[model samples]
Every structure is written in C-alpha cells, then in structure tokens.
Target: VLTRDEAQTRAQLLDVRRYTIDLDLTTGDETFDSRTVIRFTVRADQDVTDTFVELKPAELRSVTLDGQPLDPETLDENRLPLKNLTAGDHELRVDAAMRYSHTGEGMHRFTDPTDGETYVYTQLFMDDVQRVFAAFDQPDLKAVFELSVKAPDGWTVLANGITEHTDGVWKAAPTPLISTYLVAVAAGPWHSVRTEHRGLPFGIHCRRSLAPYLDADADEILDVTRACYDRYHEKFEEPYPFDSYDQAFVPEFNAGAMENPGLVTFRDEFVYRSAVTDTERQTRAMVIAHEMAHMWFGDLVTLKWWDDIWLNESFAEYMGYQTLTEATRFTDTWTDFGVVRKGWGYDADQRPSTHPVAPEAVNDTASALLNFDGISYAKGASALRQLVAWLGEKDFLAGINTHFTRHRFGNATLADFIDSLAAATERDVHAWADAWLRTTGVDTLTPRVTGDNGTYTLTVERTGSRPHRIAVGLYDPDLTDEGRLTLRERLDLDIPQTDGRPIGKRPALLLLNDSDLTYAKVRFDPESFRAVRNGLSGLPEPLTRAVVWNALRDAVRDGELPPHTYLDTARAH
Candidate 1:
C-alpha cells in the first residue's frame, strides 16, 4: 500500500500532462485488455530520478517508456517503475489484462439473476482506479483523460465525459482535469431516460429489470434534478463546468450516490424497488441536491490533500439540506437533519473513535477513509451553518463566490478557504475555525432564565469550547386554544454572552436552539424542563418539537433521564 508520504513526494516531482487509455472489452472472458498512455513532465529534483505508475492486472504484459522497452520484472505489486528519466516530457505506456471485481471496489461486474444479463461499473474510491488503468493514482496530480473502449455490440457506455458510439468502438470526450477517484464508467444494456434542461443534456439510467419503477418516478427525480441545478447556479458565481449531466442508477451500489462531475452514479434502490415513505423520497431528493452542490464545491475546486476532505463533504451536506428546502418540495428538510443526521454526529462524537471535524492530521489514505464519519458530514455542516449565522448570509455567500472564483479547476487547502472567507469580512474567521473545526466533541447549551422585579433575563450556558449562534424561543399557553402553545417570540442570541437584550417576562415554555440553526446538545432549565414533561406534544412548530425530542433522547442516553421516561414522553406526545 502507498503511504501518504510516498504519494506526496511523487506529486511534487511530477506534473502529469494527459492520459489516453484504450480498453478492449470484447473478449468473453473474465479479464479484459488495458492499454494506457500517460504523458508527464518531471521536475528537476535530486530524489526525482525515478517514479512508478500503479496498476493491478491479472496478467503482466509489455511496458514501454518513450518507446524504450522495460523489463516486466520491474513491476511489483501494483506499481511499475520508471527509471533513468530526464527532466522533460515523457510518455509511458503499459498493456495488460485486468480482471473485474465482484465487490463494488474496482471495476465491478454483476450478473443479474432475473434476466441473466451482465453489467459493469467502477467504484474506484481511493486507489482502486489503478485496478483498471495505469496512472499516477493521486488527486493532486490531475490530468485530462481521453478514453476509448471496445465493448460488445448493442451495449451502452457511460463515463465522466460525454460518450459517443461509432462502428464497434466508443470514444468518450476528453474530460477536464479531474482526480482519478472521480472518474467513472458503467456499461451494459441500460434502460435510459433522456431529456434536455437549460440547454444541457440530462440522462437517467438503470438496469433493464428496474425499468418500470424508474419510469414510474422519472418525473419526480428529474424535477428535483432540474430544481437543484438552477438553485446552485443562483448561489455560486461559477457556472456548471461540465459538458452534460448524466445520472446512472446501477444495481447493488455500496453508496447512495457519487458526484462524478458530469456523470453521477446512484444506487438503483432510489428507483423504489419496494414501498417507500415520503421521508425516503425526500432523502432521495436531498441526495440529489447534495451531489449537485458538489458540482461546484468539490468537482470544480478540489482539496489538495485527503486531510481537507471535510472541505468537500461538509459544504455539500449543508448545501444539500439547504437547497432541498429552498428549491424542492421537501420543505422541512432540517427537521430530518436534526432528528437523524445530527443524532449520528452526536453519537459518533461520544464514541472512543471520535475525531475533530477537520482533524489536525489525516496521516494517509487509510486515516482519510476513517475521517468519513458523522463529524465530517453532520458536525462539519453544523459548524458551517453557525458560520453563516455569525457572518451573515451576504458575507457568507460572498466568501463562497470568492472561493469558487479563485480555486476553480485547481486544488485548495483549509487555510486557503479561510483566507477567502477572511477577505470577505473583517471578522476573525480563523479563530472561528480553530474553535469549531480543530476540536472534537459536541457542545452542550443549557438555557437559564432569571426572574427579577416584573422582568426576566435569559442566558445560555456553553459546555464546550465552540461558540454558537443560536435562537431561543419563548412560547405562551394559548388562552383560546386548549392544550396548545403559541409562540411568544424568538430571539437570535450568541452563546458566551452578547449585548444585553430585554426579556419582558417569562413564558410557559423556553426552548434553546429552537430554529435548529446551530449544532449542540441543548438542555432546558428547571421550569422549562417541567413544562416539557407535561406538555411536549403541544409545541406549535414541528421543528421545535424535533429539537425538544432530540434533547430528551440525548438526555436519556446520558442517564440524566431514564429510558422509560423517554418512552413516556414519546407516548404522551
């Protein structure tokens, strides 16, 4: 396995120019032929005299560097060594036979039980793309890829770029500079639905057996896609930087969806193979919004190293829920986020394996894979939401536009992102990042209400290091309506104290983090806690109810409240 230090050293020494890969899938056998031609320029460094390309083929074949033959014995494990190279442009080609994977890691090959048909799709996360092609196999050493594949007659081919089929051969349009992990290909006799939206070609695909279900929900799926696409354009100054948008719903996919620039691959289960609830459908829509957000945040401006992966996923997660709420029919998306996704983060943060949202160090690809947890997605997005709240939406959007404009089609680090945000405002964003992102564990916000002579004041207790911009809701029992509470007021307040604000009088119920605008474990004061125990179900807003329920649930887990007490609260409400 390649370590982080090895990949970093290689990237500094080489500048990849381009890659032209030719694949022959004609043989009716397990192994297929692969021929890769990589052109690169090496830098003038003392330790850069030799480097290696990566591949995992079933059988060894010929290797040539600038038409000079090299011994196949030099190939070890998945790396092929290039020796005695000068500081200039050079071409390295390798011809071998690679086998397809049954697991969804590499080039996965599946045989459908219903129709006995075969399907091939690639799930090359991390270093698995080398199982199919020979390249640098690192994100920072990006290159344009031109692909040519010869598949069986009457089969469809999809890749990261636009693909066209001619006589017995398929040629994919040269893709923009993208990392190897983002490259994708799915080939078979797929049932496709094609459309054009806003002058860009759009497509959805699935296996032939699931055609009926895909057809049933085709309109809903495409509607969400179009809506998210348009909304993202409104948010980011950079336009969509791809040829077309293609979504393929493949069978037995390990992930919900992958944001592969122009080609997005989703699991076919989203096509509704069985009865699904409205929540599930909304999840589908939110995923659509999430992957579309990646089109700008992730695919356009990628992270320089795996350590900054939170830069990709966290931004997408926040945008996904936000955009779904803004654009699609899933209006109360944050409620689901509060109930489900936030819970995931809270529980994972309490675990022994807990790490920071953007940890100080992700040692290698192995550690980077471990970083894809609740902290990276939910907690990180929560921090971003708080940032938007603190910085204000206008400044937040301005920073994001600046970020996209500056790093489009290139790579960036966490500091670069903070610098962009700093440019937009005079506030200390670096300090904010330090408190929220550089630390692990969740914050606890305890509500405190003080009563004085004919008046009251409210203060929030912070249990963790991170600062929060939260909203406090005060509700009074409705006089006309029996067993219902009406909102008295909502005050947006900063944790750790702010300018004095008036609280005219106490109310029937007081809720912290009422709007779900921040991420924290909230607690009710004694009076409000007793009020919730009696009348939890009578809360006016569903989101407020969700926040209250989440707090109660967390309390039960902490043994602060009994488990049966939580059940009773559920039963009462």
Candidate 2:
C-alpha cells in the first residue's frame, strides 16, 4: 500500500500525459488481459532515479519502458519498479492478466441466479483501481484516459466518457484530465431506457432480470433526475462538464452510487425489488440528487487529498437534501434528515471514535479512510448548512461560483476553498474555519431566560469552542382555541450572548435552532423545558417540532436528560 507521503512525492516527480489501456474481457476464462500504455514527462529537480507503477495482475507477461524491455519478474506485489529513467518524455507498457474481483473493490463480477448471466462493474474507490490496470494511482496525478475493451458480442459497454461500440470492440471517448479513480467501465447485456433533456442525453440502465421494475418507475426516476439537473444549473455557474449522463443500477454494488463523471453506478436495490414506503422512495430520490450534486462538487472541483474527502461528500449531501426539497415534492426532506441523517452524526460525535468533520491531518491512507464516517457525510453537511444560514445564500453561492471558476478540472486544498469563500464575503472565513472546521467535538447550546416586570431576556449559552449562528423561535398559545400556538417571530441572531437581540415579551415556549439552521446540540431553559413537556404538540410548525425532538434526543444521549423523560415527551406530544 502506498502511503500519503509516497503519493505526494510521486505526484511531485511526474506529470502524466495520457493513459491508454487495451483490455480483452473475452479471454482468460475468468480473468482479463490488460495492456496499459502510459506516456508521461518526469520532473528532475534532484537525483531521483527510481519510481514505480501499480497493478495487481495475475500474471505479468511483459514490461517495456521507453521501448526497452524490462524484466517482468521485478514487479513486486502491486508495483512495477521503473529504473534509471531520465528526465524527458517517456512511455511505459505492461502486458498482464488481471483477475476479476468478487468483492466490491476493484472490478466486481456478478452472476445472476435466475437468468444464468454475468455482469461486471468497477468500484475503484480508495486505491483499488490497480486491480484493473497499471497506473500511477493517486488523485493529484491526473491524466486523460482512452480505454478500449473487447467484450462478448451482445454486451453493452459504459465508461467515464461516451463509448463507441463496433464489431464487438468498445472504444471510449478520451476523457478530460481526471483522477484515476473516476475512470469507470461496466459491460453486460444491459436493459436501457434513453431520453434527451435540454440537449443532453440521459439514460437509465439495469440488468435484464430487473427490466420490469426499472420500466415501471422510469418516469418517476427520470422526472426527479431532470428536476435536480435544472435546479443544479440554477444554483451553479459552471455547466455540467460531460458529454452525457448514464446511471446504471448494477447488482451487488457497495455504495449507494459512485459519481463516476458521465456514468454513475448505483446499487440495483434502488430499483425497488419489493414494495417500499413513500419514505423509501424519498430516499431513492435523495440519493439521485446527492450523486447529481457530486457532478459539480466532486467531479468538477476535486479535493487535492483524502483528508478533505468531506469537502466532496458533505457538500453533495447538503445539496442533495436541499435540492430535493426545493425541486421535488419531497418538501419534508429536512425533517427526514433531522430524524435519520443527523442522528447518525449525533451518535457518531458522542461516540469515542468520533472525529472532526474536517480533520486537521490524516497521516496515511488508512487514517484517511477512517475519516469517512458519519462526521464526513452527516456532520460536515450539517456544518455547511449552518454556514449557508449564517453567511446568507447569495454570498455562499458567489463563493461556490468563485471556487468553480478558479479550480475547475483541477485539485484544490481546504485553504484554497477558504480563500475562494473569503473573496466573496465580508465575514472572516478563516476564523470560521478555525472554529468550526478545525475542532473535533460538537457544540452544545442552552437557552437561559430571565424575566423582570413583564420583560424577558433570553441568552444562549455556548458550551464548546465553536460559535453558533442560529434562529430562536418564540411561540405563544392560541387565544381563540386551545389547539396550537401562534408563532411570534423567528429572530436570526448569533449565540453566546450577543447585542441587539432582546427577548421582549415572553412566549409560551421557546425553540432554539428554530428550523434546524445550525449543527449544535441544543437544550431548553428550565421554564421552556417545562412548557415543552406539557404542550409539545401545540408547536404548529413541523420543522420547529423536529428541532425540538432532536434536541430532546440529543439531551438523552448526552446524559443531561433521562431516557424515560425524553420518551415521555414524545408520548405526550
């Protein structure tokens, strides 16, 4: 396994020109023969003479560099040592047999039980792309790839770019400069449905066994896809940076989906094998929105290293939930998020294994992989939502557009992102980064109220180092009927005792983070808590009720409130 330091050194030493892999999937019985040709120009700042390429081939047939034959026996477990290479343009070729993977790591092969057919897809996340072809496998060492594959006569082929199928051979269009992990290929007898939306080709695919299910829900899926596409265009300045979009629902997929540029591979269960609830369908819709968001955040403006993996997933998650709410009929999406997604973050943060949403350092690949837990996806998106609320939408969109304009089709660090945000806002983004991103634990917000002669003052006490910008909701009892209360107002203010935010007249109940605008654990004051215990159902707004419920849930997990009391509140409400 290559360490982060070694990858950084290799990235500094070489700039890859292009990668051309010729794979024959028809031969070798169960394994495929891959012949890779790489052209690169090496940088010579010092007297470094040795480097290596990565591959996990079944049998190493030949190794030739710069047209000179190198011994195949010198190939180590997954690396081929290239020796005594000078400083100019160089080409390396390797011919080997690579085994297909059953695990969802490299090239996964699956055989259907009923139809007696086989399918193959690649899930080359982390560093497993080496199992398919030889390359300098790292995010920063990006290069254009042109791949050609020989498959069975009746199978369809998909890749990161459009594929040209002729005479049982599939040649993919040359992709733009992209990371090696983003390269994708899936070949099978696919049942596909194609449509054109706004001058772009869109397609959905499934195996023959699941053809009926896909066709049944094709309209719903395509409508959500088209709606999210239009919504993303409205939010982002950069256009979608691909020729077409094809989403394949593959069997036994590991993740929800891989946002592999033009071709996204999703777990086939999303096609709905059995009857599912509306919530399950909403989840499917959200996953679609999430992966579409990645077309801009992860695929377009990529992170430089694995430590900032949250920058890719967190933004996609936030955009997914919010966009689904705005564009589709899933208007209660955030409520679902507060109930399901945020619970993952809250539980993970309280656990001993919790990490910061954006860790300060990840020393190795192993450490970087561990950081992709709940903190990365759920908590990090929660923080970004808070940032949007605090900074306002106009400024945040401007910052994102600036980031896209500056670092499109390139790699960027966390500092580079902050710099782009700083260029668009008056608030101190660097300070916010230090407080919100650099810290490891979650913040706790408690409201304190004081009343003197019919005037009330409410102050929010912050328990962690991070600062919070939240909305406080004041709700008074209905004067006409005893059913629900009237919302006085939602005051947007900073927490930890700020000025100009006066709690003028007291209401029946007070709510913190009124629409779940922040990412902090909240608790009510003594009087407010008592009011909540009695009149929890009187909260008219569902969002406000969700925030309150989540606060009680957090209180129970943190041991500040008893479990029975929390359940009793729920039962009473």
Candidate 3:
C-alpha cells in the first residue's frame, strides 16, 4: 500500500499546470457550492487506463468532469474513478457542494456568541483535503492553485496568495507550487493592520471583536517578522519567493498555524485579549519564525513523500530559533528550547510511540500522520543542533543552502538531502546521519570523579546507543561565600570515548550535560547533586539555571520526587 516506486511513478506521470476554484460563501443553510478546473500534462509513455480523484461522499452534491456528467454509482467517500483516460495532456473539472464540518476538518462555519458575527474558514488536516474540493490529496502531487470566492458585501476573504477584490468577489493570484493540505481560506468581518517592509506588503488580521488587542501588539509583532525576514536574507542566496505575506489569527484553528504560502493562518487566541507572560510572547514569535521558514523549506522545495516530513519540520525548527536569536530581540531563545522544548523530546522519547527522527518506513497516510509528534519536532531539532555543533555552523549552513538550490521548486527525498550535506562537509556526516537521525531513544550520561594526591580525575560513562557531542562544566566552591560555586573550566567532548582516555582533574562539582545543547538525561555525582540543591540560584548563567529547573520539573512530573518538595526547593532558592 505504501510503495515508494509507485508514488514516484505517479508523480512523474502527472504535472498539474493550473487550478481555477470558485466558491460561494453566503449560503445560510450550512452548505456551499464549489466548482474546480484542473489542467495537467501527462507523460507520453503512460497508457490510457484509469484515473482517481479524492473527495468526500456525504458532502458531494454531484461531480462532472470536462463538462460531462460523471456516474453517481462510481462515487465513494475517498476516491472517484475514471476509465479510458488519454495520456498526452488533459483537463479535469469537478463541480460539487460541501457541507460545514463541526469537528474541525473542512469548511468550518461558526457564529461568535459574544458579537453575533458569523465566520467561515477551512482546516484540512492530514488527508482531509478532499472534504472541501476534489484533487490529488497526496503530498507528491504538487500543484498551482488559483482561488476565487463570492462572499457577503461586508466580509473579507484571505487565501494562499495576494488577493484582489471586484464586485463583492475576492480572487487570489495563482500560487507557485504547494501541497493540497497547505491551501487555506478565511472569510469574515475581520480587523486588519497593514504595512509594507522592503517593498513587500505585510499585514496582520483578526476578528473585529479583537481589534483593540491586535492594535496594541502590532508594532512588536511586525518588528519580529521584519527582523526574521532580514536575517534569513543574510543567510541564504535566494530571496523570498512568495508575493505578499499575511498572518491571520482565525478562530478555532486546529494547529498553532498553517504555513499557507502568502497567507499564514494562526489560532485567534494569539490576538491576546487577556493577560499573558513574556514567555507566551516569545512563543508567538517563535511560531511566526517557524512558519516563515516553511515558506522556503516546505513551500519552495518540498519533500517527495510523507516519510521525509522531518526534512521540512526539522529544518524549520532549527532555523526558527537560530534566526530569531541572531536577528530579533529574543537572543536567549535557545534557553526556552532547553527548558521547555527539549524537555518535550525527552519525555516523548521515553514513551511507547517514540520513533527515530527519520523513520525508515511509513506504510500509509495513517502511519505518516502519527509521526508528526514530539520526536519529529523537538527531538529532530535537538539532533540538528548537535549536527551543527559537530559540523560547524558555516558548513552546516552551506550544506542547507546547497540543498535548497538543487531542489528549488521541486521535491526531494531524505537520501537526496543527506547527499547534499555530505557534499558540503568533509566530516563524516554520512556516519553521523546513521548514528543520530536513524536512531531512537535518549542517551544517559553519568559522572564519576576520583581525587588523589591533589589530582582529580573525572570520567564520563555514556549508557545509550546514540553518540553525543556535549559540553561538560567544572565549578569550584567560592572560599569567601558560603555554599557558592564559581566557574572553573568548560570541556567540549564527544561521547563513546573516542580518545580512550579519562578526562583529567576532578572538578569540585562536575556538571554533566552542560549548556543543554544535546538531548540526554544527566545524572549527577554526590558532590554535584549537593551543589545543585544549594547553589543552583547562584549560577551566573541563566541557561544553566534553566537546565537545573527543567531537571527538577521532570522529577516532579514523573513522581520521582514529591511535587511539594520541589516547590519548596524552588522557593528556598
């Protein structure tokens, strides 16, 4: 059912040239009509046979292809069949009506109880692209989409590209090349803040009821966007590929955000009608950066299939944090990743559903959907951070740029990405890929120290199959102050004992897993444990303090330590 050869052959046989989609948005009976025209070129070698299109059965009123009525008996919920299709080049058109889904799948219609204003939007999860329109829903069948909607006079419509309005109808410019799931549209009486940066239009929007809150944070939000955009320009040779960039905070969005080319849709809660912490603002910035990266990685050069989803998410995660740190005011972004994000990786790695950062095989759409979890986003990000440390930032970036250049406006596989990286770096990136990306489970680091004749020796024993390049810190007791530890030396070492020699000098406190740069669980020696209990707050580095706080947080969550005692310890510190 999940054959790579079949998918590759299918991709080679079909090339979608254009799509003209028309939607009527003013129906009050919770149903709407849609008509789609898909023009494509077929490979010369392919013979006349059968073709299939995906769509939902219950919502479909009727289907007609190429102005000829299709047999109702041939219809099903997932796929429609056509016999004796010619191979050279062809056009397939469809007309149907779709009902609103309450479970957040497709064409969701909701009325705000507070203001009595109604809104309509689309939320196409993993394989729900068929619920709204008829098309090839798989990732490999990349296509250009042209959307037009007829809505009420007062409502505004947003889509995957720049939009132009005429006679109460909104029409979006055709998108470059994108997957079916990334297509999006929202129509409502919206509140919008518009501006221009670097000759490109930029805007942020929300529901009319939340206009004041959006206005309050407009400057900060747009500043973050401009900074990240400028930073990405400095890093890559290619400029931004899309036309206009807009971010909309829509209601009841299933995910944090969907990277829908020019129009990125986010959950309306980000408008922030209530009080929020600084950490929440940082999170919002991070998601913005993440979705922008997808405008290049996933939208421009896509993965060939679902199995290489990590290629999209992992690259975006790494770029999101690093770019924001280099270009925006959120310079301490990795601190949050260590304290909150990497902790997610560690917890999920210990669960039964854990998989490698890049799994060897995914049999079908159902299994591929399950892979989009902590191991894919968080653990994959940690692995990439380690890769940068091992390969150096310059070469890592060079490798990424090459990958993008070679695969621009096309689809690539995991092996193709690895080959590009191997070409850029002289290091054993191929070997590193095998040990890190292809492996599962978390590593454990244990510290052992022995002191004799004023000489101290610290030896680290690693207990896992995966290899790690980690930072080890050494601290000494400050003689003037009671229970205070002072920094002594920091050592960068590769685990699995590459040199076959013990690291010399027993530190007064040997801190394993320092800097929180890698994904691993650290166990402290008796002296280091005592130091952590008493002097954690005295550490000069906030990142180090965050690591200790995370360890205590995990201990409490796992019930290894009483929650009240952990709180008491934090209170005492």
Candidate 4:
C-alpha cells in the first residue's frame, strides 16, 4: 500500500517527536486550513540536507521548515522536499489548505437538511489522510498527536482521543502513538448521552435530528457497550488503552463504523430512527462490540503495514461475536454470524475480488483498500474462531495477550502474532496461518456416507486445496417426532481424511462443517439435504438452522440452486 511504503520511508527519514495540529474549524468555506509543527530529534552525525514531508498538491498553500519559506515546486503529491537542514532537533511546520472530498475521502463536509445544522466529518479512508493534513500518512510511522480545533460556538468537536473544550476551541488530549488513518474528527451540532462506567467515560452521540431515536434505545446501546467493555477486561491483561469512549452515529458514514480510537463514527442508521427487526438490533449490538474490540486489537496494537490489516480487523471481528456470546445477553450471536456474516465471507470469497485473509505483498493503498472485503473480516474471523476451537480458548487468549503486550503502542506483522501464538502452544500455528490466512479461495466440504453391516461411516472429503478444522454433526430422528432430527453427537476433525468414522447406528442425517466455524461450503449427505429441505426448523440449535439457511443462500449465489428454490426451502422450514 502507498500508505505503508510512505510510512516505511518516513520512519527512515525522521524520528517523529510529536505532532501539533491546529485547525480553524469555523472556516465556513468548503475548504479549511491547517498548521502543523512536526518536531524531531535529528541524527547528530548526519547533515539532514534533504528532508521530506508528505502532502498533496492542492493542499499546500505555503510551505516552510522553521520559518524559512520553501518553493512549492519542490512538492510531490507524496512528499515535500526540504534542503539545507542541520543535524539537530528541528521543527517542520506546514501551512496548508484543502477542499473537502465528496467521494469518501479527506475532510467530508455536509449539511443536515432536517435540522439545518452544518456538519463536518473526516473519513480519510486508505490514503486520504494526506488530503486533510501534512504528515506521513502511513500505518507504521506512528506519531503522538495533539489536536486543537476552533469550531462554531454551539458545535462540538471530537477526535481520536478525548477532547476538552477551552475558550470556544476544542483541544484533544495528546494521543498515544497512532497511525494517521486512525486519527479522526467530527464537528457539528450534536445530541449526546454521556456517562461513566468503571472509571472510563462512555458516551453515545448523534446528530440533533436523530436525538429522539437515539433516546429510544439508549439503554440497550449503553448496556451493549458496558457488556463488551467488561468482557474485554476479563479477557485481556491491558485495560482500554484510550481515554473516554465515544460512539457517534454520524450521517452517511461510508462504512458501518470507523474504529477511530476513543471517537468511533458510525452510520446514523444504527440509531434506528424507524422501526427495525429484532435481528437488526442484534446487528447493531454486534457492530458496537466489533468496533470496541478494535480499541484494543486495531487501535492499541496496530498492524505494521496494510498487508497485516487482518491482525486488526479479523481479530476484532472474531472477538466481537465471541465476547458478545460470553459476556452479553446475546448468547446466540454465532447464529447471526452464520446467517449473515459468514454469508458475507462466503459470497466474497467466491467472487473475483477474493484475496487471502492475510494477503502477502499488498504493494499500495489502492490494493489494500480493495482487500477490506468479506474475507478479511468475516471468513478471517471464522478461521480464528475455528482456531480457538482447535487450540482451546485459554491458549488462544494467552497467545492474544502476549501478542498485544508485545506490540502495544507499536506495529506488528502477521508473523509476529503467529509467533506469539506459537510461543503459547506447541501446535503448528505457522502452518495453520499459512493454510488459512495466506491461501485464497474457499474449500468445499462434502459428506460421504458408507455402511458396513449395522455400522454407518461418515467421511469428510475436502474439494479445495486449503485445509480446515471442522465439526461434523450426526443427527438422528427423534423417537417421538415424525420430522425432527436431534443432534446425536459432534465430531471434531481436521479435514481431507481418506478414512471415515464409524457410527454404531446409522444416523438419519449427516452434516459437514456443522458449526460454520470454517470458511467452506458444506455439501450435506442425501438424507441430510432432504432433512434440511423438509425440517430444518426442527433442528434444536438456531445456529444449525442458520448454517442450513446459509448453505441455501450460498447455493442461490452460486447459481447452483434457483432463487425461488431457496425461498421455497425457507418457507418449508
């Protein structure tokens, strides 16, 4: 990624001491200006004759290093050159202005029609961080950020860390070392509910127009936050790394939510201004938990490059559902994952855009942005969940704790995380990582049944190249029921076996990849397929039913089954 390369270069160029960013928020123009002072300790032995700052063309109104004016011609969209610098501590200050981007980049400005309130939010997705400020807009060039914004008198300003209002200007607490893409700010007339939990400030915010809707489900929203926070504390050695946790339901946010440290920005639709299904509410809760996990996994301990972004997102995605299931009232969260999230992974993995969960050699930001798809989030999470199932929860947690402690306030590659896991267990996690994270494409698990005398055998045949840790379920007809199939036993197995497991009694049905914990399409045995078509709802576990539903969903997407057939199957169930 361009951000990764620029970050690596900047890391070599300067030892960034701190960043002091000042913004005039009330600049009513579509464009705003910024002044940044980047102070760095120079190498005493080397004459820093040529130093560079990363900035775009239209952005730099003027440039100077320590008040000496520099030529605009020296500016490259990716870098600004500075000459005649002595080897000592020095300051590189930039005075720049940039227009807001309408296409989900840079500082995005818009006005809310309902309340007539003007709002400004920044969405610097991938490489857009440079559109807002002059810095090394890369993942590894972590910098301590001090932000000050002058906003309209009645509007509030939020950023990556906690902000204190002073003299009509909002000043953010200097952030711990963080990547620029994670730096954020939102300024507008906002409605907010503020509280504290376990000594940490917790708040939910939305535009003034959505205040009524936000108030309706305020309790549930905050309860989800409290539950996930408590759960993460129980799981990790480090507490929440940032100050004050704020979830803002902003308007027309590009993604579900941008995990911007203390200030997370969500699409206002999460406020539920209109009636929505209980399933929708569950989804909102999951998103909250997902973004919260990022506070630790993505924000606290960062990926060394865009290539290792799975270390940030996939881990958060898995922990989100797992924590919600263990700690919150959402006990059947994995069912939703199967029906919705896994479907996303399955669909994307089958598409032309599919990439490995942990992709190797992502050369620039454009390619990296393309990879923020289903495989990275959903399938990657499922793979991790299966890893937890195989390695056991305690060891997985130990490995994760070690990974976070070792990489806190720093950057880590995917290898670093796997090595930590390898330290926690003698298991071949490196091989697991290679098979699951490095390889592209999904595997197909087909259930083959054989019988000998009174015994039945069920064999799992993996059709794809990737290996899988999976669960096979044997179901038998309930003695008192006509159609219901009860789970007889669950067999945990690694896939691609040539032999089969013998059951003393023939099962009414056999299902492959029963839990949907692996990124694979499952082919049910003939009897199981018939059972799924006729009596899927009779399955005891909602998660099992979800898996069956997902298979049908996948069939529809793959054109193997007619869409109407899927609908008929759903209706029959």
Q: Provide the TM-score for each candidate, comma-separated.
A: 0.98, 0.97, 0.94, 0.94
lDDT string, candidate 1, 292-384, tens digits: 899888788988888899879999999999999999899999999988899988988999999988877777788889889888999888889
Go through the candidates in order and give the C-alpha RMSD of each one to the true structure: 1.3, 1.4, 2.4, 2.3
Task: Tell me which residue pairs clash in candidate 4.
Answer: 1-363, 1-364, 1-365, 2-364, 2-365
Clashes of each: 0, 0, 3, 5
Give the top-scoring candidate (lDDT).
2
lDDT for each residue of candidate 2 in 1-573, tens digit (9 for 90 to 100): 678788888888898989998988898457998999999988867364779999998999998998899999988788899887778789999999999988798888888997977888888887888999999988888889999999998899998888898899999999888888898999889999999999998999999999999999999999999999999999999999988899999998988899999999999999997889999999999999999998888888888889899999999999999999999999989989888888888888888898877887787777888887788999999999988987889999999999999988888888999999999999998999888888777788887788777688887778888767888899887888675777899988786655435678887788889999888888888778887887778888787788888888888877899999988888878
**Model 4 global lDDT (CA atoms, 0 to 1):** 0.82
| Tens-digit per-residue lDDT, 1-573, candidate 3 | 234555665677777777788988876657777878877777777787566777774555566666577776687556787667667667777777778776667888877887988788887756777878877776768788999999988999988878889998999988888788888888889899999999999999988888999999999999999999998998887788888899998887788988877888889888888899988998999999999999888888887788888878888898899888898888888998887788788888889888989998876777888888888899998888988887888898888889889988778888888888888988888888888888888877777777666576666788787778888888888888887778787888778765433445555667776788788777778777678888888876878878778767766766666888787778879
lDDT for position 479 in model 4? 82
Candidate 4, 1-573: lDDT as tens digits: 364555565566666668899888776567787888888755666655566667763557777777788877778656787776777777878888777766667787878888688778888656777778887667777889999998888999988877889788999999999888888999888889999999988989988988988999999999999999998999999989998899988877788988989998898888897889888888889999999999988888888778888767888899888888898778899988887788788778877878888888888778777788888888889889889977888999999999889999998898899999999998999988888888877777788788868787777777778767778778888889877889999988777775787766777777777877677887777777777887788888888887777777766776877888788887877
> Comparing 3 and 4 by lDDT, which wins?
4
